[model samples]
Target: MTQPIVEMKGISKSFVGNKVLNNVDFEVLPGEVHALLGENGAGKSTLMKILTGIHSRDEGEIYVKGEAVEFNNPKESEKAGIAVIHQELNIIPYLTVMENMFLGRELKYGKTGVTNTKKMKQLTKEYLQQLGIDLDPLALAGNLSVGQQQMVEIAKAISVNAEMIVMDEPTAALTDREIERLFEVVDRLREQEVGIVYISHRMEEIYRICDRVSILRDGEYIGTRDTKTVEYEEIIQMLVGRELGTLYPERDAEIGEVKMKVEGLTSDAFHDINFDLREGEILGVAGLMGAGRSEIMQSLFGYRAIESGSISIEGKPVNIKKPTDAIDAGIGFVTEDRKEQGLVLSMSVKENLSLPNLKGVSHQTVLSEKSEKELVDDLVKRLNVKMAGQNQEVRMLSGGNQQKVVIGKWLGINPKILILDEPTRGVDVGAKKEIYHIMNELTKQGVSIVMISSELPEVLGMSDRILVIHEGRIGAELKREDATQEKIMYAATGGE
Candidate 1:
């Protein structure tokens, strides 16, 4: 049996009187991939942060290889052979791959301490080769795709010769091929006796790569079990404390007449895409990574430069050259990548809730504080955003709650046509259900919805019609009843 690489017991942490982690216990064995399963606010991130010294625990004890230690900072944790690759890539995009790998620890050759770029590149190449990863070390980090940048982070973690590595949803944005490559890398790391803590919402991945599983719910340890022995349903039951039954909500109602139409939509990022969204309908766009689903939405919303496109609202052709134009056309967009584009993390919940409704809050060129508060207060209650009050910073809220703010902000605009890109991405199961109900509510109100999602279940469950995009073109459109996994996957992968 492999030895335990790291262990924590009685781990409890609180921030500003809120108990984020409550007496959690976690463990990882050498050469094993231990999956940490939980909802977004289940204290998974907080527990990992405490382990890595991002935050000190309010009460707990940590043991590395049977030796007690307290990590005061990330650098110290790295020295102790532990590293973390977050969901958001931490690489400096402008720097070369080799430079990023050796950042803050560059090799010096002479008394003058001259940086040796060649040595760094050679070392990086060797590390990449170790994992059977082929790439140009001299290539700029920014030029690489999201998946490639993720590989760079893995290379950097390996370069440190760390004993344990924690990956937070590493394959969230990766393609099928990229995910296979990631699994291969994990196998290689395991061969090197490096324990791994894999955090992800995708159950299929846990069954594929994880050796053992640890579940946490509401900041407390639930249990750990052998992946080979436990079934997926059992694991989910342990994590969520409830049976999911059907993973997706039941669909009702039929798609109606085309309420919004796009023809000859062309942008530098994407080209020649056309689709129609119907009244009381949900049309889903499915694609692989970088297949331009988000790009199409951005072009439609007038956030990007559309070289050519004819957009029609309610069957009337109109011009939307900017966001203001889209707004005037009664279009609301909930962007993908919620952290970067969807919500203002620095602002309060009330401010973010009223973001898209600034015009409503402005009375004769002056901001109406009372109206803003009233609007947000009602939205908060309606959306069930769990916060102290409307004045709390959005960043302080959980991922699930923050998503509600984004939806509420757009709903307040009362858009006739809503474009939601990856609406439930990275949200917990409960929150996902909330978003689904909200979509149903909007459709019941005769508002048209265009949902772009990579998750096939979500696409099929929520969409009245599915439009699969491949190679910057609409490959096929299928009715919800006809949208099977095999059919959609075939279209998405450009298969006949």
Candidate 2:
């Protein structure tokens, strides 16, 4: 057998008395795409961080090409031929693609202390071309689409002469065509014998690209197997450490009378949209990226201006030109980018939970700590938010817990209509189930929900009715009984 390219033995890491990784073993071989599978908070990220020198392990032995090495920083790890492409891309949006490629390690001109721009651009262009990327080297990072930017990131890795690449959810924001292109790049890298560590929650990608699968459950290594020989259910069971039973819970909410109605809704991004959301119903908005699904929701939530529309709640017309108006009208919106748009990261969990209904927690022109605490405590307990304490910073929580906090904060508003934009976007399966249960509970309490999701399974499984938006128009409205993945895709792509 050929020697492994990268190996970790007896790895363990702890944070503030919490053991995140415990004696976990992971390795990758040259020319192999090794998948690091785990649920959120299952220590996948922590383990990867340790390997990339972003975090120091409390106990472990790391080897590169059969030689022991201890890297004290990310630069050292990169120098040792390991590069990480994080889920949330780390790129300077204002910088040009070529500039970003050689940001830290620029070529100098013969002791003149001047950067060799021509050399950097030439190298970046060659690297991008090698990866089958056609993006212009001089283009600003922000001007490129998500897919193009990801390609630039990969090209940057290659320019650094990285032998091993760790890609975290590389396809999360990519379109079908873009994903295909990425896979092409991955195949080329594999052909060149570069070891790749692929981490993602999407099972289909694992089956499509990975050679070997390794499961981590609650910070413990379960086992590894050849991807081709492993059953899909077996992988799920291993990562979760139990039978999932079902990906989505059974719907039990009884649809009631129409609680909110929209007529001839038009915006810059969408046009002439009409829909009715019933009490105790989950109305799912489905579409491809940039199909205006989020734009419609944002307009309805008063985050964007509606060109023409009539919104009625309980048979009464309402004007919502701002978020405050929407909130006053009993509407709650959980934005798609939770970290940037939904929660205040610097604030404590309790403080964020109390933000939606500050007046309710205040007393006569002054804030009341007792009232605030009581409200936050109720929300935290009700939502099953995992936090050290109410005073803990929200940014400290995991992606799943942070999402729960975002939802819990909106629940504090006691809204009659709730709008969730990609509520389970980056969360794990366990977290996704918890969020679904929460949605179910909300509908049970007579709250109507407008859920916008890119994941078809999520929309089909949870929604009582699905609205497919295509090219800024309502292409199809599918009843719960009629919607399927194929049908949804057909409609979402502008099928008649």
Candidate 3:
């Protein structure tokens, strides 16, 4: 057997009195893609931070190619041929691809302050070519798609002669095509004997690209198994430390008359979109990236102007020209970009939760502290948001907890109809199941839902019916019993 490229034994870490990683062991082979997976607060990131020198391990032995080493900072890690590609990319948007790639270690004329721009550009091209990326070296990073910017980041890592690369949620924001491109690059890296630590919650991708998976729960290492010999259910069990009965709950809520109706919902982003949301129904919206699924929902929520449209709530026509009007019409919207659109990261949990229910917390025109506390407390308990306190900033919570707060904010409104866009995009499987249970509970209470999700399995599992959008129009509407990934993809691509 080949010596592992990197190894960590008896790793332990703590923050203030809370232990995060407890005697965890991890290893990566020269040409293997090892998956590091767990729930939101499962200590995956903490271990990686220790590995990359961003944080010091309280107790551990780290070896690079079987030689013991200690990294005091990220620069030291990179010098030792280790690099990290964070979910939030390190790309400087204003800089060109070449400039970004050669940022700190620019090629210079011998002993001179002047940068060798020509040599830097040439090297950038060569590195990008090695990854099979054909992007221009002179293009502005801001002008490039997220996938392209990610490629630039990878090229920069390769430029450092990195033997090990850590990719955290690399495909969270990419389209299907972009994901395919990233997988191709991973294959190339594997061929070149580069060790990759792939971290993501998407089980499909883990099975497809990763050779082995390691699990952690509540800061303890569960175990590692070869992907070829592991069942996905087993992985979920390791993640949650229990049997996750089913990914989706039963849809027992009975369907009733239409709660909201859209006719000729036309806008620059979409056209002639018509749909009827029956009471207690989960109407799933599915489409590829840039297919206007989010745009249509945004327009219905009055975030965008419609050229011509008519909306009827409970069979009564309403003029919703703005968000306030939509809210008044009994509409609650949970946006796709939860951090940017659905929540104020700087505010406290109570403050964010009370933003939409201001009227409820206020009697006539005056605010009532008692009402606010009651509302916030009830919602937090219901959503099971793990936080230090209600006063803690929303940004301090984990990804799954933050998403719960977003949904909770809307739930406080008690609207007749709820619209969720990419509701569980970055959430873990445990949190996702919680959300599904919550949705089923809401539907059981006769609340209608419009769910826009890119996860096809989610659509098939939860929806009473699925709508496939193609070129900004509803291409096919299929009952849940009749829908399949193949059929949806075909309709999403304009097939009849």
The lDDT per prediction is 0.88, 0.91, 0.93
Q: What digit string (tens of lDDT, one per residue) describes model 2 on residues 138-236?
A: 899999988898888888888888899999989877877788999999999999899999998877789999999999999999999999999988987
Of the pair 2 and 3, which is ahead by lDDT? Answer: 3
Q: Write the per-residue lDDT of candidate 3 for residues 146-207, one digit (tens) a residue.
A: 99999999999999999999999999999889999999999999999999999998999999
Q: Rank order by lDDT, top first?
A: 3, 2, 1
Candidate No. with top TM-score: 3
Best by lDDT: 3
Off by over 4 Å in 3: none
TM-score of each: 0.95, 0.97, 0.98
Q: Tens digit of lDDT per residue, candidate 1, span 1-496?
A: 6557899999999988989899899999899999998887899998999999999999989999989989999999999999999998898999999999999999988767999888999999999899898999999999998889988998999999899999999988888789999999999999999999999887778889999999999888999999999997888688778886766666675567888888999887777888888888989899787778888888888888888878898878988889989988899999888889998899999889898899999998899999988888888888889998788999989887888889899888888999999888888776787889888888888899999998887888888889888878888899888889899989889986
* Candidate with better lDDT, 1 vs 3: 3
- Candidate 1: lDDT of 227? 91
**Candidate 2: segments with Cα more than 4 A from true spot:** none
Q: Over 4 Å off in model 1, which ranges?
A: 110-112
Residue 294 in candidate 2, Cα distance off native in Å: 0.3
* Each candidate structure's count of clashing pairs: 0, 0, 0
Worst 10 residues of 2 by lDDT: 239-248
